[model samples]
Target: MSMAKDKELVLSHISLEVRKLIKMYAAVNECTQVEMLERIVLEWNAQQSRTERPPGDEDE
Candidate 1:
């Protein structure tokens, strides 16, 4: 399975403070900002997948 086919490009807006924070975190972690954002998003997705869903929500 190619994940490239499952992904979509997105544009987002964030406050300057948040942008600066991301940049600093990326620098400290020795990664580009884009990689840092992807890591955060992938971790969130993993967390969501591990969460239990409410009854009758299986179709989603």
Candidate 2:
């Protein structure tokens, strides 16, 4: 699927409960919702990259 379509599919699958949780966490952490989401996405991407890297790769 195209990137835009994938993004839409992902967004559509998110439940209201999860959305509320994200908002609550953002509020409790004193950060904007978008900032919190960006941090989460970055962290997840980093983790995926690390896992996909070679075992001997220390640069990760």
What are the runs in model 2 whose C-alpha is more than 4 Å off?
1-13
| Cα shift from native, residue 4, model 1 (Å) | 9.2
Can you list the residue pairs that collide in candidate 1? none
In terms of lDDT, the poorest run of 10 residues in model 2 is: 1-10
13-43 per-residue lDDT for model 2 (tens digits): 6688876786888999998655666667778
Native-referenced Cα lDDT, model 1? 0.65
Per-residue C-alpha lDDT of model 1 across residues 4-50, encoded as one tens digit per residue: 33233321455678768878989999987667767777887878876
lDDT of 2: 0.69
Score residue 16 of candidate 1 by CA lDDT.
70
Using alpha carbons, what is the TM-score of model 1? Answer: 0.60
Model 2 residue 2 lDDT? 25
Compute each candidate's TM-score over C-alphas.
Answer: 0.60, 0.68
RMSD of each: 6.2, 4.7
